[model samples]
Target: MVGHTLELRGSPFLQEIIREVPGGERIVHCLQCGTCGGSCPNGADMEYTPRTILAMITANQRDKVLKANTMWFCVSCYSCVSRCPQKIPITDIMYGLKRISIREKAYQETDAPALAKTFTDLLDKYGRSFELGLASRYYLFNRPLAMLKMGPMGLSMFTRGRMSLTPTRIRNVDQLQAIIRKARELGGVS
Candidate 1:
């Protein structure tokens, strides 16, 4: 039975989104190196360590791989990215997998997806990210406690210009919209 091992072995979209990083091949080249496992900050809690993720990806068991807890636990710390002997941008791969999973509407993250949408909308509105608007929407729509937690150290960060209460918009907003339009078509942004 094929079960869910992989989807017929010729997943073109997987190849499309997966960049040809110089040394990124041979996620199979792993030496059973505990390096990634040992280096991961959240490895202990993961059902699959970074090493296991690599194996699963190479096996073409990506759906199973994406559903695992390790991907969810990743903080995108780039710790594994720097240390890999294969020099694979494993973090980028994780992000790519998350993107596909998200685009398919397969699962959900309590706040990250909506917040990501808001951030993407902000990017489409301007050329870059705006933390203030993102945080406001995140707090208002999802977690009110985040506002209370930040309330203590919030003002100091604001005055230092580390955070802005107002969103800074770029002069050419239309150009940004065009970019988002293209990205949505190319399967990068949803």
Candidate 2:
């Protein structure tokens, strides 16, 4: 675990996050049991594990917590949440951290923010994911070289009928947009 050398103080930042996230108040009950960390699929890539992030939240390591890549590493697999004995809604907390990081401009330089934006843009525009479009857009800006590398794999998937050439729009996309709009108005994930 990375050392949290930040000065300790009361964290209104954490309080605000707790209020924003569904089931986030349960964060205060974290047991430091390491289950969340152990259960995380990408735990090895995180600067702080889920358990450590919770501790940092309680310890008022606002800057460290906000800047850490732990939040970005979360794949939303819900493994940690399912394994948590305290049922702390670890994934939701990760989402809250991501939102806070974006709002505060505190995250490290990474493709995560770009990928998230790309996904949301595609979803909002088409009412569903368009993998080819998403890959094209994401690679155009983030890693043009990676696009070359992915060509063979993409071709393989296409040949195998595992990848679609066209995006499938959901029925009643206007209703989907309305629901998303209402969720955003109600302080749901943006």
Candidate 3:
């Protein structure tokens, strides 16, 4: 009889971890060539650039990166990946790193509390986002007073149907959940 390999617990399956995301392995190819840093609109604002984050993760310094403002400042623009000579998926790394940071509660941005609650609640309740529901949830989560300060201007667009009232779920919700479960198991956000 052939013996099956034993997988240890809490021991990083680095290969499995990298394969969890579609383009994560590309992060390993970064040369620290500074292309990502140079292309970022907010480069001057970050102590550590996207390239540096990738380097830190590879060095097992993920906690250090999680504590920094760099992840919060990323605008989710794909410019870094688009211009990467190594074809590294810098944007996805930024997202994965942010998920880890938020999951750990290592860094908190005050403006994000409403957003975080709304996103989690959306995923939990409807298995997707309803734009109007999200907006209302965010406003309410932030409190009535906070939204009241914005006056009629804040309520205008949402009331006009610029934001849809419908909830949309991706097809194959179970598969999506399974993928998300894998991420959560690895200490990443759903």
For 1-190, candidate 3 gives per-residue lDDT tens digits of 1231122212242243365456776655668899998999988898798777766766656567778777677788889878999988777776666665666677755456458667876885557867677767787766667677755764687687666657887677788678677876886322
Better of 1 and 3 by TM-score: 1
The global Cα lDDT (0 to 1) of model 3 is: 0.68
Model 2 lDDT per residue over 50-74, tens place: 9999888877788998999999989
Q: Each prediction's TM-score against the native?
A: 0.75, 0.85, 0.67
lDDT of 1 by residue, 9-99 (tens): 3344334344523334445345667688888899999888888877666556766765666666778999987898777677776666666
Pick by lDDT: 1 or 2, better one: 2
Poorly placed runs, candidate 3 (over 4 Å): 1-20, 113-117, 143-146, 158-190
Clashes of each: 0, 0, 0
The CA lDDT of each predicted structure is: 0.69, 0.85, 0.68
State the TM-score for model 1. 0.75
Clashes of 1: 0
User: Which clashing pairs does model 1 show?
Assistant: none
Report the number of the highest-TM-score candidate.
2
Identify the superior model by TM-score, candidate 1 or candidate 2.
2
The lDDT, on a scale of 0 to 1, for candidate 1 is: 0.69
lDDT of 3 at 118: 78
